[model samples]
Target chain A: MQSEFAVELRDVVKQFVTPEGNLLNAVDHVTMQIKNGEFFSMLGSSGCGKTTSLRMIAGFEWPTEGEVYIEGKPMGHTPPFQRKVNTVFQNYALFQHMTVYQNVAFGLEMEGADKNEIEKRVKRALEMVQLTGMERRKPRQLSGGQQQRVAVARALVKLPDVLLLDEPLGALDLKLRKEMQLELKALQQELGITFIYVTHDQEEALTMSDRIAVMSKGKVMQMGTPVEIYERPANRFVADFIGESNFLEGKIKSVSADEASVFVPALNAELSGVPMSKDFVNGEEVVISIRPEKIRIVDADAEKDGVFRAKVINSIYIGSDTHVFLDCNGVRLKVMEQNHISRLDPHSFYHKDQAVGVYLIPENTLVLKKEA
Target chain B: MLQRLRENKAWQGTLLALPTTLWLFVLLVIPLFLTLVVSFGRRSPDGGVIYGFSFHNYLRLIGYSTNCPAGQSACFDPLYAQILWRSLTLAFWTTVIVILLAYPLAYFIARSHPRRRNTFLMLVLVPLWTNFVIRVYAWMMLLREQGVINGVLGWIAAQFGLPFQPLQMLYTPGAVLVGMVYEFLPFMILPIFTSLEKIELPLYEAAADLGANPFRTFLRVTLPLSMPGVVAGTILVFIPVMGTFIVSDLLGGKQVILVGNLIQNQFLSARDPTFGSAASLILMIMTLIVTYFYTRKFGFGEEIITA
Candidate 1:
């Protein structure tokens, strides 16, 4: 059975009055659903309204126009403390004066729980975050990662209906961030609580989210699994945003159930893929995006296969792999090759300014719909 | 040798602090040492130091001798101790009153919007910009029998056709307290406000999310975080009020005498520098002990608010 949505925002709009007498819309009419027991993420750049949307669900802010519902109950003008949601702010917002135990027990104290129960839940939550003995330590005494875990424990101890994390890993270094991402995903799974994560980092969204809603300009552009977002992006923005991809402008020549032929102007050749939207007609201008890894470097003399002759612009050695950049049909594409015994052959290393044959698999090419 | 000198950071720090060390030695250490010496020395008939070591000065502090036609003989007096006790009581009450009034005002200023906060702070500080003597005189004028307060009270009574005289409000302990609080109120507000203002808003939000409501958040987070200011303000207001002579002299008239007024009398009126220095040294010692106690109790931990 599918888990029900724990938090839902229906056509919510949030606006702020600017000093110039203009109403600046931070979050437009956006609707979203976060499933219970799932680590859902709102992924976007700064000023993309992802945080605002999360804050709406957390009841920190009331929508200018629309309703937010938690567990199917309408939440109208509810303050943050009254809501069954806790947020982990980017800075970890720990109480400077409180010990970790006191910070974690804050919610329980608010609920007027018995002292024993508060202590038990706080201990349990701290244990869940792997901060058992550090409960009595002040937040400043902890490292960034430990402080972040304390913030998580503070929210988790409340057993809120949903845990909202707003760039919780943004302050961490790369290695710590990667570790916390995995720990957070595992913690979400173990606690069985809905986690609504907000971040502008695409790698964070890809690594932790069950599904991500790609936001831009105060609106959700696409919502899908990370693989789906990378492989079959609905529009040009998603294809460019999710990962490294090279695009070519083309015109649709023909359409079929499984494939669509487009006139590739650079190579004067026909490109084929399944268009994401069916509304595209003949002679419609479209963009085709092919992931960099899809392009393969082949020997120019290796049989006249479906390949184009190109020049290698640059080659980079990245420890475990070598990235070869080639200019194909006036478009730059990168090909990554894992360093291995066979690849160690002297002739296998392609240098810059060398002529090479680049082949792109038809199935790997993504046909994107034009966004108005 | 150059490299070794560059590496000697502890020596560099000590060198940097040398000026302050010398300053303290000259201003603080020397005077205290001198005061101790004077407390044990004898005072001449003209109130100058005779440089003779004796217990007579100490004996004279508790009870002096009456010089008749014969010679100096012992008499008894406990008035100084009683005065010291009264001074302690006044200082204690002044601290309590300042804390009670300063807390809410400081809280409001600390949490208010930037523009409004500055405006409110300006209001609190406006009275301080005027001359201290003038502010005290203003209070003196208001509390006097023929002043605005009594005139207003008399007018109200006459408007209602009641037979009554203006109430005696000036020259009382209440008037002294009013003047002391007015003079020192801003000292209390500023420190508490600075501490409260330094508290991050997210801390309060975090506290609330942990299940605290507004008041609980204030008690747990706001109060404790602002303890530095509260303690600083308390010490600042208490020490000065204890040593203050103007409020009691102007308002208490001859009805009451705080320790500050007594110390002032010993310096100027009694012209007994030896006894004055002894009492002054006692007050200074009390101040140092209280300050030491507060600093030792609260030195290097999170500021604690008993509330």
Candidate 2:
């Protein structure tokens, strides 16, 4: 039976020896399975081992422990040329000495394909990236965005089972990067080839990935869809990393199948029906995370079970939303309000030090385990 | 006045180039112009240049000679032409051999670890600390019949009870070629190493990812990218090898007579300043022609240094 995964990393670990005589685990024992034709992303900041993990998959580095497999066959020290995979490097890595057509045709030429066939595939690949007329230009003559497209075309022309990208658009400006993100996602869908993209950009990852593996400190924190990862983060790190969250320390008061009651001493109130990431015992310490947009500033007389008094310290009007900074009994919190009304009314803005009642919607709040 | 001059970029450029311009006019331009003039003038009875101008020296340099016996026309002499051709061939071979030897050593040094790479580069440059003539003389010592190589071979042969004869390696074309290659090898290595080291590590990975094996990667990626260095090193070695006479004089002895020896003999031994001036002008013209065609094909070697 054929394996469902196009690429699989089974407990891969890579260690590097530092100049100071210390052994460092650049990539710890990490396992991941990328489904066939799925756009999988590994996301983290610099030095978080995300690139190291991708390199292991590309056979640039061998794992000190465990193994990598492609198409259900173990890749035991297989050199990169023998592997049926291609990479779009961060720097675009186009051959500077060659024209765009030659760069795109290098792979087919190496495979000993007929000259006409190579030329036809190279033409089609360049056309796919919309670089048809610019075939004779050198890489140094192309702009950054154009060079990135050339790199993508060069890798895709090989028609490998999997394609790896290491921050392919990290050099572009914001507007071009956003446009390319959408275009790359569309291209992946059109080609039906599995893509393993590595990037530190959370927005780019969330925008294009079918599933993302959030990494920190050489370990995968969580792996799920964008909605599942952002809404129900597994731990304090995941919640804090994926999006902005105001964490309040608390102790578990009651537990159930899908909800928990947390008694937050800072807010001097008990939050009931809070969504739980895991079942916790009563009297166990935890942190309750609430997105700023989820917590609303309601009228003082509203009848809510989880309503608490807060004093607004500052209010920032940020075009689309107003960020209201509040102090609730020595615990600082941020609440975001969308500007739904028109004409910039003075009555819509909250004054400084105005006492208000904040409502914490039970289902929107998440309870996570405390990090050491 | 200084502020006004600074405001005008043309004036600023002229002022900055003033010293070098004057220096070139005094040392290089004036000497070359004098050589050209002397080449056209006739030689006096006491080997001094006379005021009359003619094409006698030029015609004589290209095989026409004036020492015909009384009624016949001027005869053809192939001595100087043969010397010039010999010099060209020797320089060409020296450049080719040096490139073959230096390219691999440069690759080794460039790919070595950073700490060891520095040591290797220093080793390549260490011999240059000595004078050029001294280095050539050292080669003479090794290649002589009674030299260190023959001495070691003699010892080995005596131990095995074989016939021991000192081979004649000195005063031959091979000796001169060996000396030229040894002396000019560093010029080739340094530039090639610079270009090779400037290549980023990711390009190799990208090539392999594109299905190129290691040998194919070197042929397509490494070799093409390092052409600027090869061109620069070739020019640096070929030009010097063409004009240098010390290595031939010390190693080739009387067997190898190049154009450099011809020019030296005319000026010093034969006291024919006019003939020497003609030879010098011809050498300059030949060098310029070759350099022009070379640069047209491969460009100025500026890219290797900048890269």
Candidate 3:
């Protein structure tokens, strides 16, 4: 049986030495495990050390502390070329002098494969990346997306144990990026190789990853599946970063094993949700997060126990849906409603400066413990 | 256009270019053309060209100087061919030496940390800021017997209790080569540095990602990308080295004679304008042929030829 983790980093720390002899911690104590045949993503904002962590795993960087292991073997001081891991950089870094065929064949050449085997493998790798028949063209002659595909083919041609991609599609256009995202996901599944992808794009992580480690300030903020991260985030940073949400300051009014009631200071009412964090005492300060789509809009005349009244401040007709901005108590809340058959012209019921009531889905709203 | 010419802007550009273009034509091109014309003419006793045409200068260059006096062997002799051959050989060796030395230095300047790179390049160029003659003269002092180098060698030999006579380092072919390399090394470095600087680091990283080691990456990627600089630097160093005279005149004493020395002797000491013109024309033709092949080999097409 295969090992549980294909790539593992334990308390990896990387500090860059300045010319004046000061050290700046670029990657600080990052520890994570990537499962075999899984598309694992490290998502974070810029300068958050996600790429540094990925480089450490790829053997391009040596951690200042702790070790990086791949396939149950210690990669103590291995160079990047000697490691059985390949990287696809953000800029697609294709060799400008070589043709596409030669770029893909470079690794096979290094492996000392037979002439026929090298040609066959290079062609196969190019086919995998859908870059067949353009083998003779140099990088400058190709489009950005094509260059990116060639970079992928160059790395994938090595057939390493794990493939590390540092925002590989960042250079492509939106349409091309989306297409490549799907292609990358399909390719990962078909090849069944461990893929450790790094990106600042949450949508990309949500779309392609089997599991994601959300990073911030050189630390892993949370790690879980897409649905788990979206439905039940660990903290304010993860919740606010992964998706759109409205957070309200509150205090716990009643605590239970599975449920809790938090009194919202802004609305002057009690809000109920599943307590996703540690134990909370009564009257303890807490925060509640609720997705906009989970909140339902009701007319003022319609009476509902869980409904709270809100005034429509602004409304936008976005092609497939209407984005309604409402003032709940003193705070503004955005609500997205679909233009489905059952909800035809929902905005017709309300206009700007008109009052309406919002019903929050108790199950969708989460009560997170107050972070220091 | 004539209409646009009336706008005065055209005249301004023409005015700006007038002095340099006229200088080049009158001082450089006209003199060269005069030399070519004189190459086919007979020499008057007064050291001016006679309008009569003859193949005597060419025949004399091929060692048919029988009509010339035997005592004037230094002025009209078969040594011109040997001088040309030696100049070519020395220039080739100098080009090779400078290129090997400049490559690593250029690569370091191009790829090292930006804050220190400028300072390093400036240090390399500091010696060039001095007058060329002064710099060559400084080498004379350094290489002379009982100079700074000899002082150091004598001191080291004294510590070992060995014979301490100053070594024969002055007025030799070796000293001339040292001066030539020192004078032309910067010309080789600057172009190579420019080309190396333009090579993106991502290209090397991509090569590594494709499983190539450092050596293979340099051979497959960096070397090909920087060939333009290599070609430019080689020609820049080689052509001038072949034509240079002062370094050899000062450092070589009477030990050697290059093509440039022969050319100078023909026009000055020999007072033979016809023979000098023939030699100059031959050199010009040889340079043109070599340049054509060099640029063509490096894939420089109309761009370099026209430039």
- Per-residue alpha-carbon lDDT of model 2 for B151-221, expressed as tens digits? 99999999999999899999999999999999999999999999999888899999999888999899888
Residue A123 accuracy (lDDT) in model 2 = 94
Tell me the TM-score of model 1: 0.91
Across residues B1-307, which tens digit of lDDT does each residue of candidate 3 receive?
Answer: 6777778886979978999999999999999888888999877898878866787777766566655665654344675677777788888899999999999999999999888889988988998899998988998889899688999998999999999888787788898999999999999899999899989886777666666789977877787788789889998999888888898988887776787777788799888888888887777776677778888776731122211
Q: Model 2: what TM-score?
A: 0.96
| CA deviation > 4 Å runs, candidate 1 | A1-3, A19-21, A275-278, A301-306, A337-347, B1-7, B41-43, B50-78, B115-123, B152-164, B292-307
- lDDT per residue for candidate 3 within A1-372, as digits (tens), equals 466889988998899876689987877888898889999999999988899898888777789998998987778888777888999988987766668887788888888899899899999999998889999987889999999999889889889889999999887889999999999999999999999999999999999999999999788989999998998898888888988888888898898896899888788888775555667788888788888888889887667666888999988877677788899898888888886644465646458889888887778788886772
lDDT rank order? 2, 3, 1
The global C-alpha lDDT for each of the candidates, from Candidate 1 onward, is 0.83, 0.90, 0.84
Chain B TM-score per candidate, please: 0.88, 0.93, 0.86
Could you say which candidate leads in DockQ?
2
- Report fnat in order of the candidates: 0.62, 0.75, 0.56
List runs of model 3 lying over 4 Å from the truth.
A17-23, A273-278, A341-349, B1-29, B52-64, B67-78, B300-307
Please give the DockQ score of every candidate, comma-separated.
0.53, 0.56, 0.41
Lowest-scoring 10 consecutive residues by lDDT in candidate 2 chain A?
Answer: A339-348
A1-372 in candidate 1: lDDT tens per residue?
A: 333789888998999887788998888889988788888999999999999898888766789998999988889987778888998988999887778887787777778899999889888988888998997788889999999999998898888889999999999999999999999999998888999999999999999999999999888999988888888887889888888777877888988875788888887878766454556788888888888777777877656544788899988877777889888768777787777655666676788789988877778786766552
Best by TM-score: 2
Error of 2 at A168 (Å): 0.8
